[model samples]
Target chain A: MKAYAFLKNTPKTTTPRGKTMMLDKGLGLNETEDLLATAGDYLDYAKFGWGTAATMDRELIEKKTAMYREAGVIPYPGGTLLEVALLNGQFSEFLKETQALGFGGVEVSDGSTNISASNRKQVIQQAKDAGLFVISEVGKKDPKLDHKLSIHERLMQIQTDLRNGANYVIIEAREAGKNIGIYDADGNIIENELQELAKGGTDRLIFEAPLKSQQVALIRQFGVGINLGNIASNEVTALETLRRGLRGDTVGQL
Target chain B: MKAYAFLKNTPKTTTPRGKTMMLDKGLGLNETEDLLATAGDYLDYAKFGWGTAATMDRELIEKKTAMYREAGVIPYPGGTLLEVALLNGQFSEFLKETQALGFGGVEVSDGSTNISASNRKQVIQQAKDAGLFVISEVGKKDPKLDHKLSIHERLMQIQTDLRNGANYVIIEAREAGKNIGIYDADGNIIENELQELAKGGTDRLIFEAPLKSQQVALIRQFGVGINLGNIASNEVTALETLRRGLRGDTVGQL
Candidate 1:
């Protein structure tokens, strides 16, 4: 039973929608348990944020993945780790290691480094072949590189990634969620850009709306079923309130 | 046993100065473990933020307090809970419950309520009588009410609280750290206001710096050992990095 059961309201969309992807940036075993305990029901994917998974002990990573899995949340390494592995010509090793670490999913992206289209597709397909739910990210870690990729390019990549066997494609906003991809420098959404990119059916896309403003805007624009990513662990419960229209911003609107 | 042991340099003005009172806003056991594991050495106090302590299970609170105690960190409930108890006229019961909950400290504040100076002193004395580390907070929860408190009034309260056996005095910057007390609407510190209020020895004053920019500014102005409060649980490691000049912003400047 929820603590605030009386405040619970039926969500707008009933279909399996609006998956939340939490950004785990170097959380220890205890923190992971806390996260899973509090907001695990609302979370779908837990990404050990950019290159942090590689920095921690393999045993600790496995423990976290197990906890997340037990909570019914798919755990995956950040896309930057995949980029690093690919850059080092260790994509196969990366896949094997991720599996061994008890991760149920893999995030393939060219956010931090460049990867050819053929290789990107292969990575997505290969992860799927390994029985892992594949999530590919679009947008660059560098704002300069990200801004250069037009909305059409973003949509095309999303379409291609989904076509190539990615279960879901994440719109990369990095951890900061500012001045990259759909969000502006102040972390506000650029409506026209978002509309263009989101044309690739929103069902297959998880927008990385890390900031409160971004989350609010995305929830407001797309309603409760807008999948959000890169949410800080602490903000999980607060985000759920927004999604469920429990918060002041979405209370009446949703 | 730090990651970059070779790069470690002795910080300037290191005399075991100033307390670091972190805000533990509803952290679960797992999250608390991660926080202590990563940044336990730097933390002196851990405050369960707002009325979050009252909202959590007693066992969980005890367990969390134990974890902080083991890490040599003093665990306390937030002033909001104190305010709630005071409002209900259960001040004595509140102190008893806090002590029974394994908390080492109590924050006496009229943040959300108006308490007379005599009653405020009694609250401070009562906590002190209970053998608890008494830390009184000076400011209002409402931004408008908080703004009305002149720097002179704030300074007077700090002195009074200290004279009445309050161990430390915390300046208010609610969880958001914006448009309250010393901070502007954008969360930036108003320099002239800060200068006036900080005439009280910075050692006994805990500035609630929830944002990185605020933390950075406070650390820069007051040096590394300034007592900072309301730091987010996850940002504990990041704040320590800033204090130690490990992060890019403060790296050579500090």
Candidate 2:
């Protein structure tokens, strides 16, 4: 049973919350299970952030992936890892290792590298073909370069990725959620850009809102159902509190 | 064995790191064990942030505290809880409960409330006499009030807390680590204020550095052994990277 179950006024999110897609930077096996036991019910996808997956012991990564799968959350390597694989001509090998490790999904992103437009589409299709749910990201990792991409360009890329077989498209905020994608330098959301990006419904889009203020702002703007990503693993329960109007920040407002 | 043991050039700290004082806002038994398994060797203290301990079930808190204690980490309730207890005249009860729950330390602070000088000193001595390591914090949690506290006042409080038998005095940066303490609005360190605070050696002072830049800055300035506090549970290993010169920011610098 949920803690404080008697608080019936806590908004029941009939729609599964895309409210939490926690970033599993480098959690060990015990940490993975701990996360499952603590906030598994609140999470949807767990992304092993950046190129970290390529750095850890393969066996440990496999165990962590299996744990996430067993807990019913989609487990995926970060897009940066995929980008690294692509850069090294190891995309196919990476996909095989991904499946061997028990990951349910694969992210296709060029956040820290570059891939041709045709290759990006082909990679997404190949990943889908490999039976992994694809979560493609649209933004450069570097703030200056990320800002250089126009809203129209990003929107087009999102549409293209979806058409090419991405289950969800992530707006890249890297892990810090600042000066990239929809967030400004102070990590605050750029309202106009966010509104433009949300021209399409946000049901399949995950905005990486790692900062608490960013999380609060997005939750307020799009209600609790907002698909938020790059949340630190520990913040999962805290984010749930905001969605259910349990925390002080959203209690009266929500 | 360390994960990247082959990365032999990673600067090993000859000095003990104060990187262990992590903020546990709300963690259960499993999460506690997971943290120990992943980073226990590095941690010296596990603090349940704010009055969160007062809000959780005593049994659950007991289990969590026992886990931390068994792992050799001194577990303690946040100073705000002690402050609340002092406000309600439940200081003795609070101390009893803390011991009952297996906490190895007690934090006494006037962060959220005023305690007369005598009361503050007495509280610190009482907590110490009760056989708990006393770690006192000095700062207002509110930004405006925090700004009013001149550097001299904070330095004096640190000295008083230490003289009253505090095992270590934590510079109050709260969990956000910005605008309220040695950091500016952007969370960057204000070097002059930090230098003034650290005029007393950092060995007895745990600077609450919750931001990556702050961690890197302090680690660079004070070497790897500098005591830090309010570190998020997940970032312990990441902070270790900076200390050991493993990550990009501190790779060559440290």
Candidate 3:
């Protein structure tokens, strides 16, 4: 049972959503266990944030992945790791090593590197064939490069990724979540951009809303069922409160 | 030993000349372990942030406090808890319970509730008499009320609290660190106001800087020796990096 059982207010989901993806950036094994113990029920996916998994001991990574899986949360190496593997032309070795480390999913992203449309589709298909939940991200790591991606291009990419067998297409905002994709410089939503993106429906799309304001806005705009990614581990309870209209900002407004 | 020990940096005071207090708001045991393992050497005090200690099990609080104390970090309940105790006229019980719970220190403040100057000093003295380190806080919790505190009033409070045998006086910014005390709406330091407050000298004061930008700016303005409080558990390592000029933002500049 949840510690705050009496405080639970059921969230209104527009669809059957299965997960909350937490971005874990450099959390030690002990910290990971605490996170799992506290908010594990609320989480479905744990993404070891960009290149961080590579920096930790392989044994540590295996241990952490096992803990998450044991708690029923699918563990995955971030897309940045995949980009690095592809850069070295070692995608097969990357997939094998990820499996060896007990990761259950693969994130296919071109945020930091260029991958042609055909190659992107192939990568998604390969991950799916390898029995991995393929999550593809759309947007550039560089703000200037991301800005050059027109709404038309983003829409096409999302559609392409979904068609290529991606379980979820994440609109990239990076960790900072500002001046990228649908968010503006202050991490506020650009209404027109969000509108265009949601036209395809948000069922298979996860918007990376890292800031509280952004989470509030997204929850308000799309209701509680809207999938959000890149949520910090500590903010899990606060985000759930926002979804359930428990926080002051979303109290009666939701 | 610390990573990158070869780097020449400003030597952190051997005795921690001024206290560095960290806010611990609902950190699980594993998270606490990670925090202590990483930056425990740099920290002098750990605060269980605002009514959070009351929410957790007494045993849990004891365990956490013990961990901190073992690491040479004085652990205490936040001032809001003391304010709660004062509101209920259980000041004596508060001190007794805090000691029993393994807390090595107590914070005295009227942040969430109003306390007369005599009462505030009495609380500080009582905590001291109980063999606990006493840290008093100045400023209201509400931003509007906090903004009404003039530099002269703030300076006077700090002076008075110091005179009353308070170990250190903290300038309140709450957890958000925006539109309170010396920070503006965007969490930026208000230069003129900060300059006026610096007349108190950075020695006996701790600024609750919860934001990275605030940490960076404060470190730059007051040097790395400036006492900062309310640092997030995960950011403990990041803060040490900033202080040592290891991070990109402060590397060459500091």
Chain B superposition TM-score per model: 0.96, 0.96, 0.95
Cα lDDT for residue B228, candidate 3: 92
Report the C-alpha lDDT of model 1 over B41-97, residue by residue, as the tens digit. 888999876555554456677788889999999999877667656765677777878
Off by over 4 Å in 2: A1-22, A26-47, A50-62, A68-172, A181-254, B13-15, B88-90, B244-251
RMSD of each: 7.5, 7.5, 7.1
For model 2, how does the per-residue alpha-carbon lDDT over B152-250 read when each residue is reduced to its tens digit? 999899899898899998889988888988999989999899999888788899889999889989989998888888889877766776676544345
The docking category that best describes candidate 2 is incorrect
Candidate order by decreasing TM-score: 3, 2, 1
lDDT of model 1 at residue B216? 94
Pull out the clashing pairs in model 2. none
How should the candidates be ordered by DockQ, best one leading? 1, 3, 2
Which of the CAPRI classes, incorrect, acceptable, medium or high, describes model 1? incorrect
Candidate 3 positional error at B231, Å = 4.3
- Name the DockQ score for candidate 3: 0.11
Predictions' DockQ, in order: 0.12, 0.09, 0.11
Question: Ten consecutive residues with minimal summed lDDT in candidate 1 chain A?
Answer: A1-10
Alpha-carbon local distance difference test for all models: 0.83, 0.83, 0.82
**lDDT by residue for model 2 over A1-254, one digit each (tens)?**
87667776576445455547889877877777767999999898998766455445566767787788888899887776676567657778788878877889998987767789999999999999999999999998768889899999999999999988899999988778888899988998899999999998898899998999999998888888899999998899899888888888998776
